[model samples]
Target: MKSILNRRNVALSGGPSRLLAVAHDAATQRTAAASDAAAHDPHAASASGSPADSVVEIESRAEPAAGATLPGEGASGPRPVSTLHAVPVMPAHLNGRPVQIADGAAFEALRAADELTTFRVYRCFAYTVSLFFHPPTLGYFVALHQESVLWRALKANDLDAAGSAFHLMQEQATRLADGETRRAQLVAQNAELARLIEESETQAERLRVDLQRHSEQEQTVTGRQHQVRKEVAQLEAQRIAAQAQLNKAHRALHQLKVATSEGVPHLHAR
Candidate 1:
């Protein structure tokens, strides 16, 4: 029963240093008690094992053996402290800092004041403070957590402190959310700009290709025009030479006819 009590205490503390100290003390006490019994009767030493063995047994009971777990714990380890209490033993951080929240009546007052404020920010994150009114303590217990991890908690009879903490956490959470939103917007805008730049570059490249093709076409058309002009000049020269030869033939025919008429006697036109 005493060993069981020691084990319960060790489990409740859940600190390795504390467990070691408690185990050592229990072992020393058991060793002294065993030594006393053994001195009283020499046969008692043989009946019960050595004092060293008793001490070892006490120490073992005081602390779980390596790789062993307490009742209700898995082989991995004991459950987190938050599971047993309203808040974590060590709170997790957000952006390298923990958020503070107020509990109970203070939380209600802050919420009411927030509604009246013109610039209201929405709660975009899952962090929140929960409150429970304790009849026995006549106080409010405030817990800040997201999922299974509790970030901060307090019990306050003074509602103002709890309210201040709750609103502060709310503000911190909103600021983080707004920052994330801005970052996302910037990233999207940059991506859109990059896409536009790539599209413009592609269009410019296509225009360059079209310009090159049109230049080649113009060069081919200019060469064809030059060749056509040369052919037209040659045709014009040939037509002029043909006309001169025909005129010479006509003149010769006229001279021959006149000579024949003069040689023969000719009657005047009557």
Candidate 2:
């Protein structure tokens, strides 16, 4: 998605940060310059008192014209009031990354409309960068990261390269966000897979226990079959012995009957 400038953004145009940073630096310089001037120029100190006195004097006579003199103000005649304009300063860092201020086209345009803009300056590596202002939206963007060559091109005033780098930076940021999201998703998926593997192992363990029980039952059945076979064999042998004994008794009885008949016949004949 094309990003809308919010917490993260930048415009790699003409020296925007350079201009903003300069503007900010200019304000501080102006105050320092004023102090220096006051100390060095006796006439200035006589007219406007001192740097400390000038501040108070300016505050009291906010609308006094330059060269306007105060009553009882010694020999230096009337002293013009110092200009009281605001000095613009950009933030020192963007999202914890150290940055250096550079010039930008957008800032130049805004500086042209100085009455309307609150421009800012920044540092991009060893290079300087800038930001634009819009009174209507009251919004601006701070670039989190930029391509190395992109900043170099922007510094060299290579707008073509700068624009390309800007686009590349956008893509880089989106890809990074996507990469993190995918990583998180993979981590969650891996956790789920690990859980499934654990459950499968538990089920396999139960099946193994069931298989062991079945094997033991089978062994018991096999042992019983062997015992029954031995008992059948013994019963078969006992039956065979009983039959033989009965047959022997029968034979003896038959022989005894024959002998008795023979003895009776002999007695009758006599």
Candidate 3:
């Protein structure tokens, strides 16, 4: 009887243990399934409850095709980029030279200003400042402005505005360079034109001198022609006087011959 009781207690305890093992196994399996389901369902971990499905959302947000300006975007007004009113404090040696700033400070300052204005200021300063030593400050300012504009545009759901801002920044830089190049070309062209004009004037002066010399030569020729005509007239007058003297001499000779003939016949007869 004692042995039978012990056997029955052992059987009952073994049954509960088997049942518990089965329950634990089922619970573990269920937990694994739930984990698998959660893994498959991407929305499970997302804040918006649904995971981004499209390739675009997975990569980057979509932008509008046509370039358009959204409302309340970019610089406040169409004002020119401002100048650097004050330089940050630096060591005595770097006071007058380009000064480097902490990236954080530069970024904060750029973020506080208008995006367009900030970009303009950066560009303006970049033109005047050396970027090598001041790379941190310049890079920070550019990144800050870019992020601010991008964030603002995205928040407002204004893709066009964001694109426009980016394009405007690029265009403004290009235009500035173009303007400088054009000005230089204009200056060179003006100088060339001035030089050409001077050369033309010089040539004209030389031509004028040649013309004046030619005119003098013409006058001299005219005077020589007049003297030649006067000489011709004097020679014609002398020829006419010589012809008259010859005629008178011929007449006297004829008279003398006739008188001689008549006197010879009279003397012979005497």
Candidate 4:
């Protein structure tokens, strides 16, 4: 019993508590058998000395049996490492449709399987579905996956069922992809609209600046025109005064000529 407990404790999978339970059960059974044997043999208890001593001897004898290897284990040391194979408990078809993988073993096997073909959808979001043909079982498996985890799976034994399952998964993926494509397009359109709005605002600002500069030029021209009008008025008044003074000087010269002619007229008249 001690040897069995020690061996079980050394197992890679089951922990020490399991070993303890197994040891306790084995010890009880051996004790009960020894007690029966002793009760049948009137002198057996005397021969064994005590119940504890008998138990010790039975455990020692059981050590060799405990050491013997179970199926798939080696003759000595730890049990051999082996891969788990999922037994197919699900029916091949249910109501003329390929059955989904709900069995624990089948689901695990699907996770460990390598993909024969895969398709990814949803653009930025990574959603995937894959097809795999398990050579051992000669069946097809399809799975819906995201990251490292599989969300759902289907199993099929023949090509017709496999095709149906594949198409079903493909349809689901395509529907999701359609929504993602629309979302991507909407984002792109929004970005483009924002760019156009920015450009329009920039152009409007430039036009505003140009209009302000043109207004300043108009104001400068108006100020210069006012100064030019003032100069024109002053020049007009000066020209009028100069013209009047010249006309008066001319009239005075004519009058003096007339008086001189009057004084000298008698000789020519005669």
Best by TM-score: 4
Number of clashing pairs per prediction, in order = 7, 24, 0, 0
How does each model score on lDDT? 0.62, 0.50, 0.46, 0.67
RMSD of each: 19.1, 26.0, 24.4, 17.1
Could you say which candidate leads in lDDT?
4
Q: Tell me the tens digit of each residue's lDDT in model 4 across 1-270.
A: 466645654543333223434554766876787788787995886676666664566556545445545444344547567999998784657448666574545666555565233332222245576666666667766777656566777777766676677677777877867878799999999999999999999999999999999999999999999999999999888889988988998999999989889877466655
lDDT of 2: 0.50
lDDT of 1 by residue, 1-270 (tens): 475565556566663334556667767787788878888987987787787876676666655543345454465664557545475465433334443334435545543454212122224556554554545445554555555355555555545554555566676666756777788799999999999999999999999999998999899999999998998898888878878888898889899998887999867997
Off by over 4 Å in 1: 1-170, 249-270
Tens-digit per-residue lDDT, 1-270, candidate 2: 022111012222211122233333444555687778876886875575445453443333322222233333435645558999999874344334323343455544454666233233444333333333345444332233244222321211223333333454445455656756688789999999999999999999999999999999999999999999999999989989989988998999999999888877445555
Model 1 steric clash total = 7
Answer with 1 or 4, whichever has the higher lDDT. Answer: 4
lDDT by residue for model 3 (152-193), tens: 111111233333343444555555567677887899999999
TM agreement with the true structure for every prediction: 0.38, 0.30, 0.34, 0.45
